[model samples]
Target: MLKERVINETVPIQKIYDEEIMKAHFSSETLPSVPLVYKIQPGSNQARKNLTPTLPSSSSFDIPDAYQSTNSDETFLIYDKLVSCKKRVLIFASPK
Candidate 1:
Protein backbone atom coordinates (compact mmCIF):
# COMPACT_ATOMS: atom_id res chain seq x y z
CA MET A 1 0.00 0.00 0.00
CA LEU A 2 2.81 2.40 0.83
CA LYS A 3 4.45 1.72 -2.52
CA GLU A 4 1.95 4.01 -4.28
CA ARG A 5 3.40 7.05 -2.54
CA VAL A 6 7.05 6.20 -3.17
CA ILE A 7 7.90 9.25 -5.26
CA ASN A 8 11.42 10.25 -6.29
CA GLU A 9 13.11 13.20 -4.64
CA THR A 10 16.16 15.30 -5.45
CA VAL A 11 18.61 16.51 -2.84
CA PRO A 12 21.58 18.82 -2.94
CA ILE A 13 25.07 17.64 -2.04
CA GLN A 14 27.86 19.76 -0.66
CA LYS A 15 31.52 19.19 0.15
CA ILE A 16 32.80 21.52 2.83
CA TYR A 17 36.45 22.40 2.97
CA ASP A 18 38.33 22.58 6.28
CA GLU A 19 35.99 19.90 7.51
CA GLU A 20 38.66 18.98 10.06
CA ILE A 21 40.35 22.31 10.52
CA MET A 22 39.24 22.19 14.12
CA LYS A 23 36.68 20.07 15.89
CA ALA A 24 36.35 22.08 19.09
CA HIS A 25 35.92 25.70 18.07
CA PHE A 26 35.65 27.94 15.04
CA SER A 27 38.16 30.69 14.37
CA SER A 28 38.21 33.39 11.70
CA GLU A 29 40.94 31.57 9.84
CA THR A 30 38.84 28.41 9.72
CA LEU A 31 35.68 30.03 8.39
CA PRO A 32 34.86 30.10 4.72
CA SER A 33 34.88 33.58 3.15
CA VAL A 34 32.27 32.79 0.54
CA PRO A 35 29.62 30.29 -0.43
CA LEU A 36 30.88 27.00 -1.83
CA VAL A 37 29.62 24.69 -4.47
CA TYR A 38 26.16 23.11 -4.18
CA LYS A 39 26.01 19.86 -6.06
CA ILE A 40 22.79 17.93 -6.68
CA GLN A 41 22.49 14.22 -6.38
CA PRO A 42 19.93 11.72 -7.55
CA GLY A 43 19.86 10.26 -4.04
CA SER A 44 22.37 8.92 -1.57
CA ASN A 45 22.34 7.61 1.99
CA GLN A 46 25.83 8.99 2.61
CA ALA A 47 24.39 12.49 3.12
CA ARG A 48 22.34 11.30 6.05
CA LYS A 49 25.41 9.88 7.77
CA ASN A 50 27.61 12.83 6.89
CA LEU A 51 25.21 15.42 8.31
CA THR A 52 25.35 14.34 11.98
CA PRO A 53 28.60 16.18 12.56
CA THR A 54 27.52 19.41 10.90
CA LEU A 55 24.52 20.32 13.04
CA PRO A 56 24.58 23.37 15.32
CA SER A 57 25.49 22.86 18.99
CA SER A 58 22.10 23.94 20.41
CA SER A 59 20.39 20.97 18.77
CA SER A 60 22.75 18.25 19.91
CA PHE A 61 21.31 17.08 23.29
CA ASP A 62 18.90 19.52 24.97
CA ILE A 63 15.45 18.23 26.01
CA PRO A 64 12.52 20.26 27.29
CA ASP A 65 10.96 19.24 30.63
CA ALA A 66 7.39 20.03 29.56
CA TYR A 67 7.30 16.97 27.32
CA GLN A 68 7.61 14.75 30.39
CA SER A 69 4.18 15.36 31.81
CA THR A 70 3.55 13.78 35.22
CA ASN A 71 0.12 12.30 34.43
CA SER A 72 0.41 8.67 33.31
CA ASP A 73 -3.10 8.67 31.80
CA GLU A 74 -2.27 11.65 29.61
CA THR A 75 0.90 9.95 28.45
CA PHE A 76 -1.00 6.81 27.53
CA LEU A 77 -3.59 8.83 25.62
CA ILE A 78 -0.91 10.52 23.62
CA TYR A 79 0.73 7.20 22.87
CA ASP A 80 -2.55 5.70 21.71
CA LYS A 81 -3.21 8.59 19.36
CA LEU A 82 0.25 8.29 17.88
CA VAL A 83 -0.22 4.57 17.23
CA SER A 84 -3.65 5.06 15.68
CA CYS A 85 -2.30 7.53 13.14
CA LYS A 86 -0.41 4.63 11.53
CA LYS A 87 2.03 6.96 9.90
CA ARG A 88 5.64 6.05 9.31
CA VAL A 89 7.58 9.12 10.37
CA LEU A 90 11.20 8.97 9.34
CA ILE A 91 12.92 11.60 11.40
CA PHE A 92 16.34 12.04 9.93
CA ALA A 93 17.52 14.48 12.58
CA SER A 94 16.01 16.08 15.67
CA PRO A 95 16.93 19.16 17.67
CA LYS A 96 18.91 18.27 20.74
Candidate 2:
Protein backbone atom coordinates (compact mmCIF):
# COMPACT_ATOMS: atom_id res chain seq x y z
CA MET A 1 0.00 0.00 0.00
CA LEU A 2 1.00 3.62 -0.54
CA LYS A 3 0.17 7.00 0.96
CA GLU A 4 -0.14 10.61 -0.21
CA ARG A 5 -0.84 13.89 1.61
CA VAL A 6 -2.40 17.00 0.03
CA ILE A 7 -3.65 20.33 1.36
CA ASN A 8 -5.68 22.41 -1.05
CA GLU A 9 -6.51 26.06 -0.34
CA THR A 10 -10.16 26.93 0.21
CA VAL A 11 -12.31 27.52 -2.88
CA PRO A 12 -15.86 27.08 -4.05
CA ILE A 13 -16.86 23.48 -4.76
CA GLN A 14 -18.17 24.36 -8.20
CA LYS A 15 -14.88 26.03 -9.16
CA ILE A 16 -12.91 23.04 -8.03
CA TYR A 17 -15.18 20.62 -9.87
CA ASP A 18 -15.11 22.76 -13.00
CA GLU A 19 -11.34 22.89 -13.04
CA GLU A 20 -11.16 19.13 -12.66
CA ILE A 21 -13.80 18.51 -15.30
CA MET A 22 -12.15 20.73 -17.86
CA LYS A 23 -8.79 19.01 -17.35
CA ALA A 24 -10.35 15.56 -17.56
CA HIS A 25 -12.65 16.34 -20.48
CA PHE A 26 -9.87 15.61 -23.00
CA SER A 27 -8.81 12.41 -21.32
CA SER A 28 -9.45 9.12 -23.13
CA GLU A 29 -11.08 7.50 -20.11
CA THR A 30 -13.17 10.02 -18.26
CA LEU A 31 -16.15 9.58 -16.00
CA PRO A 32 -19.63 10.66 -17.03
CA SER A 33 -20.75 14.19 -16.42
CA VAL A 34 -22.79 15.17 -13.37
CA PRO A 35 -25.15 18.01 -12.60
CA LEU A 36 -23.71 21.10 -10.96
CA VAL A 37 -25.28 23.20 -8.25
CA TYR A 38 -24.04 25.89 -5.92
CA LYS A 39 -25.29 26.63 -2.44
CA ILE A 40 -23.46 29.19 -0.38
CA GLN A 41 -22.58 28.11 3.12
CA PRO A 42 -20.71 29.38 6.12
CA GLY A 43 -17.38 28.28 4.75
CA SER A 44 -18.11 28.95 1.10
CA ASN A 45 -15.08 31.18 1.10
CA GLN A 46 -12.81 28.31 2.12
CA ALA A 47 -10.98 26.29 -0.50
CA ARG A 48 -11.04 22.56 -0.91
CA LYS A 49 -7.86 20.83 0.17
CA ASN A 50 -7.00 17.15 -0.16
CA LEU A 51 -3.87 15.05 -0.07
CA THR A 52 -3.31 12.22 -2.53
CA PRO A 53 -0.13 10.38 -3.26
CA THR A 54 1.86 10.89 -6.45
CA LEU A 55 1.44 7.88 -8.67
CA PRO A 56 4.68 6.21 -9.60
CA SER A 57 5.78 5.21 -13.10
CA SER A 58 4.49 1.67 -12.55
CA SER A 59 0.75 1.65 -13.29
CA SER A 60 0.27 -2.00 -12.51
CA PHE A 61 -1.04 -1.40 -8.99
CA ASP A 62 -3.86 0.60 -7.40
CA ILE A 63 -3.71 3.00 -4.46
CA PRO A 64 -5.33 0.18 -2.46
CA ASP A 65 -7.27 2.21 0.12
CA ALA A 66 -9.69 5.05 1.03
CA TYR A 67 -9.64 8.26 3.04
CA GLN A 68 -11.49 10.55 5.46
CA SER A 69 -11.56 14.35 5.65
CA THR A 70 -11.19 16.36 8.81
CA ASN A 71 -13.81 18.76 10.11
CA SER A 72 -11.26 21.13 11.51
CA ASP A 73 -8.08 22.31 9.87
CA GLU A 74 -5.66 19.58 10.85
CA THR A 75 -3.38 17.00 9.33
CA PHE A 76 -5.21 13.77 8.53
CA LEU A 77 -3.21 10.57 8.37
CA ILE A 78 -4.05 7.60 6.18
CA TYR A 79 -2.86 4.01 6.47
CA ASP A 80 -2.98 0.96 4.21
CA LYS A 81 -5.68 -1.65 4.89
CA LEU A 82 -3.62 -4.53 3.47
CA VAL A 83 -2.31 -5.08 6.97
CA SER A 84 -5.52 -4.63 8.99
CA CYS A 85 -8.21 -4.85 6.30
CA LYS A 86 -10.25 -2.12 7.96
CA LYS A 87 -12.22 0.42 5.94
CA ARG A 88 -11.77 3.73 7.70
CA VAL A 89 -13.16 6.56 5.63
CA LEU A 90 -14.35 10.07 6.41
CA ILE A 91 -15.74 12.97 4.37
CA PHE A 92 -16.14 16.51 5.62
CA ALA A 93 -18.75 18.42 3.70
CA SER A 94 -19.50 22.03 4.38
CA PRO A 95 -22.46 22.93 6.56
CA LYS A 96 -25.72 23.31 4.72
Candidate 3:
Protein backbone atom coordinates (compact mmCIF):
# COMPACT_ATOMS: atom_id res chain seq x y z
CA MET A 1 0.00 0.00 0.00
CA LEU A 2 1.25 3.48 -0.88
CA LYS A 3 1.45 6.08 1.90
CA GLU A 4 -0.43 9.29 1.32
CA ARG A 5 -0.57 12.70 3.04
CA VAL A 6 -4.20 13.08 3.99
CA ILE A 7 -5.48 16.59 4.55
CA ASN A 8 -8.95 16.43 6.05
CA GLU A 9 -9.24 20.16 6.60
CA THR A 10 -5.79 20.97 5.14
CA VAL A 11 -4.15 22.01 8.41
CA PRO A 12 -0.52 22.57 7.31
CA ILE A 13 1.86 21.73 10.18
CA GLN A 14 5.24 21.24 8.46
CA LYS A 15 7.66 24.21 8.32
CA ILE A 16 10.08 24.68 5.39
CA TYR A 17 12.39 27.38 6.76
CA ASP A 18 15.99 27.72 7.97
CA GLU A 19 17.98 30.66 9.42
CA GLU A 20 21.42 30.08 7.88
CA ILE A 21 19.83 29.62 4.46
CA MET A 22 18.12 32.99 4.64
CA LYS A 23 21.35 34.72 5.69
CA ALA A 24 23.18 33.36 2.62
CA HIS A 25 20.34 34.18 0.22
CA PHE A 26 19.86 37.78 1.37
CA SER A 27 23.61 38.48 1.23
CA SER A 28 24.03 37.46 -2.41
CA GLU A 29 24.95 40.56 -4.47
CA THR A 30 24.12 39.09 -7.93
CA LEU A 31 20.54 38.42 -6.83
CA PRO A 32 17.74 40.80 -7.79
CA SER A 33 16.79 43.73 -5.52
CA VAL A 34 13.28 42.40 -5.12
CA PRO A 35 13.46 38.62 -5.43
CA LEU A 36 10.68 37.05 -7.47
CA VAL A 37 9.66 33.97 -5.53
CA TYR A 38 7.13 32.04 -7.55
CA LYS A 39 4.64 30.17 -5.37
CA ILE A 40 5.01 26.65 -6.82
CA GLN A 41 2.47 24.12 -5.58
CA PRO A 42 1.40 20.54 -6.30
CA GLY A 43 -1.53 21.31 -8.57
CA SER A 44 -0.69 21.94 -12.27
CA ASN A 45 -4.26 23.14 -12.89
CA GLN A 46 -3.74 26.14 -10.62
CA ALA A 47 -1.63 28.05 -13.21
CA ARG A 48 -4.11 27.39 -16.02
CA LYS A 49 -6.98 28.46 -13.79
CA ASN A 50 -5.38 31.55 -12.25
CA LEU A 51 -3.44 32.92 -15.25
CA THR A 52 -4.44 33.53 -18.85
CA PRO A 53 -2.12 32.17 -21.59
CA THR A 54 -0.21 34.62 -23.78
CA LEU A 55 1.65 34.06 -27.03
CA PRO A 56 5.24 35.17 -27.48
CA SER A 57 5.57 38.67 -28.96
CA SER A 58 8.25 37.53 -31.42
CA SER A 59 5.90 34.98 -32.99
CA SER A 60 2.27 35.12 -34.09
CA PHE A 61 -0.26 32.99 -32.22
CA ASP A 62 -1.15 31.05 -35.40
CA ILE A 63 2.49 30.59 -36.52
CA PRO A 64 4.41 27.42 -35.66
CA ASP A 65 8.06 28.49 -35.67
CA ALA A 66 10.77 26.33 -34.11
CA TYR A 67 11.81 28.00 -30.84
CA GLN A 68 15.44 29.11 -30.98
CA SER A 69 17.49 28.25 -27.86
CA THR A 70 19.80 30.93 -26.47
CA ASN A 71 22.91 30.10 -24.44
CA SER A 72 23.44 31.89 -21.12
CA ASP A 73 26.21 32.09 -18.46
CA GLU A 74 23.61 32.23 -15.66
CA THR A 75 23.25 29.25 -13.37
CA PHE A 76 20.48 28.49 -10.86
CA LEU A 77 20.90 26.05 -8.00
CA ILE A 78 18.28 24.25 -5.90
CA TYR A 79 19.37 26.39 -2.93
CA ASP A 80 18.58 29.59 -4.88
CA LYS A 81 14.99 28.44 -5.44
CA LEU A 82 14.40 27.82 -1.72
CA VAL A 83 12.91 30.32 0.74
CA SER A 84 12.69 30.53 4.55
CA CYS A 85 9.97 32.22 6.52
CA LYS A 86 10.09 33.21 10.23
CA LYS A 87 7.76 30.28 10.76
CA ARG A 88 6.01 27.55 8.79
CA VAL A 89 4.11 28.55 5.62
CA LEU A 90 0.90 29.44 7.39
CA ILE A 91 -1.41 31.98 5.79
CA PHE A 92 -3.59 33.14 8.66
CA ALA A 93 -5.18 35.99 6.70
CA SER A 94 -8.71 35.44 5.43
CA PRO A 95 -11.19 37.27 3.22
CA LYS A 96 -14.53 38.52 4.57
Off-target runs (Cα >4 Å) in candidate 2 are: 1-7, 26-96
True-structure lDDT of candidate 2: 0.39
User: Model 3 over residues 55-78: C-alpha lDDT tens digits?
Assistant: 545322332111111123222111
Decreasing TM-score order of the candidates: 2, 1, 3
Q: After superposition, how far is residue 96 of candidate 3 from its true place, in Å?
A: 28
lDDT by residue for model 1 (6-85), tens: 12112223322223223435668656643333322222335444433444353233233333233232331132112233
Order the numbered candidates by lDDT, best leading: 2, 1, 3
- Give the runs in model 1 whose Cα sits over 4 Å from its true position: 1-23, 33-96
TM-scores of the candidates in the order shown: 0.17, 0.24, 0.16
Judged by whole-model lDDT over C-alpha atoms, candidate 1 comes out at: 0.31
- Range of the 10 consecutive residues with the lowest summed lDDT in candidate 1: 1-10
Looking at model 3, residue 50 earns an lDDT score of 42
Per-residue CA lDDT of candidate 2, range 1-96, in tens? Answer: 001111243344555656655665654444543444344322333322224456556433444223333446343444323333343343334333
Q: Residue pairs in steric clash, candidate 2? A: 6-51, 8-49, 9-47, 10-46, 10-47, 11-46, 11-47, 68-90
* lDDT (0 to 1) per candidate: 0.31, 0.39, 0.28
